[model samples]
Target: MDYDIAIVGGGPIGLAFARSLAGFGLKLAIIERQPLAALARPDYDGREIALSQRSVRILDDLGVRHLLPPGGVASLAAAHVLNGGAKRALVLDPARRRRELGKMVSNQDLRRALFEGVAGQDGLDWLVERDVEGIAFEPASAALSLNDGRTLRTPLVVAADGRLSQTRQAFGLGAEMNALGRSMLVVKVAHEHDHGQIATEWFDHGQTLALLPLQPRQSSFVLTLGDREIRELCALPPAALAAELERRSKRRWGSITLLSEPFRYPLVTTFAHRFVAPRAALIGDAAVGMHPVTAHGFNLGIQGQATLARQLAESARRGSDLGDLRPLRRYEQRHRLLCRPVFEATNHIVSLYTDERPHARALRGALLGLGARTRLPRTMIGTMLA
Candidate 1:
């Protein structure tokens, strides 16, 4: 085998997984199709990842947190969910007073941090601008054929590609994928009124909106609408769109001005039938792609990759087979337990809020009221958030 383990992705999750095994004396290779220059300097893609407290701790331990760009991270002090047109909201505040609920970091900054952490490792080989033409798994190892006519063998392989993972498809693993017709349009906008560092989730009849606080008067707006409605909204001129946002928001922010180009992301949720195949395993979005309504997608990815990495590292220390199904099964078990409930809850929330039926609305309103009165669930959320 050319390497003990080969990671088929150079994204943050994959890089973090590689970094997690840094102290272990194991041969590793990271296969990435992205150009090295791009990896070294990733572009700002308007994605502000709301990382849970646990995730922040993981990144800090991996030494990637300090590499993040200064002033690029924000604090989420509290979150409130509003159902339909109800004046009241299900409030979720931080566990402690005057402290943050979680940290919000940009995707580009995270990628830069991950690249810095993984680029200079001694026991790892960086395979750049390479495509996997084919993959075959065996009892002993997995053979990955690259587009450059190179066949690399590894005792273990991990697919950290993405939600629509090519490696997973090649491995013939099935996934439960839901392509929701709604499209989420995200953009940063400056407002006249201050947001007080509070995150707000508003579930309207035909749209679901979230306003994540940034600075005093700036926030990232995520508005979900039907596919056609989203295309029309995206097509609107900046001025028209700004007015539309302001009108839709009911001038709660006083007035809104577009700060960046709107980014439209189609809402799709996916979960792999299994997280492992023979000598291979899946991590991050490859294993479970989540709906963003719960704001646990990226956090779960970090946690999932961490779980797999921990198991692999322990196996390495014990001189056991890295390809053994025992540790892989353990990883899958732990990660699935973490993601399954959240996935189901997110789906339920989307359904309840998106449903326009009278009974559904009343039920959603009642649930929101119950959530507001409940302390245990909010406390659990606070515990989950960093």
Candidate 2:
């Protein structure tokens, strides 16, 4: 197969790229190992994603916003940050800024929306159940070899295969993984209380827990803890684990019951040494695996894909080779410049809040208090959501 762009990985990020490039007069093909039916299934329990206002704007521009399922999206109106025992609370109101803090939607819904949006778009092709075996870059084109002995040749290749991207490694642009020695236990639960579009995060000494409101009576809980603690939590019976979560959350939403089996994902920081190499470029987690505490991983991926699409479109319009080093460099520069600071700041925030030392705890409490009362810090946070 020959194409102008061949996108590896058909996850949300890759789908977003295809959607963004829908109207553009560029031939695009998305290759994925999973079939369309499998991708549409909601078997995975880790279904929630926090979508920032900026992310919403990007989806809106692609004409895929309305594809979101009914009652599957929740607007984040307020966020409350508590220190350990709930003695200190920092509340942020998105209404003050005249913009939603973010939106919460099921990961399945997001994938389905993006997939449907790209279905009939011109110059787009989705090749499912095609496992990539290798990628080779030539002087004029890049070729992807599939496990089935098929080859896809394109002028530009996008690696959105995720943190452990085979495409990235195949291109000799593997990332440096910095394990934070932590894992997140994620699950959905039925809350008795009306959370009313409120998202809450509690920072204890060893764990940072978030209760993100979903639809009418659902919420997703993410508990970040050390690997040992995660193992212990997972080993416990579902009832026991639910009890522990209720105790830790102070039963804020009344009695908590596990609605799904718990899952753990190792928390790590990964950065590709280079986002671009010859005829190839990396997007989303293939480029940067962000810490999930800031809830920016998927958001960053969406933005990264959007930026790449814009850059590629402009390059095509200017009669420049989309796969040229110069065009790829521009995409890399823009994404790195936008992602680096957020990455560093989120890492710092994790370190500070997870520290059990007396001084660190005191400082963290003070900072949280200041953030709640001061306009500057609040505005900075508002900008993140915006």
Looking at candidate 2, the ten consecutive residues that score lowest on lDDT are: 38-47
Best-fitting candidate, scored by TM-score: 1
Error of 2 at 296 (Å): 1.0
Q: Please identify model 1 stretches exceeding 4 Å from their true place.
A: none
Q: Give lDDT per model, in order.
A: 0.88, 0.85
TM-score of 2: 0.94
* Candidate that scores best on lDDT: 1
Residue-pair clash count for candidate 2:
0
Tell me the tens digit of each residue's lDDT in model 2 across 210-260.
989987668898998889999889889989998999887778788888888
Q: Per-residue lDDT for 154 in model 1?
A: 91
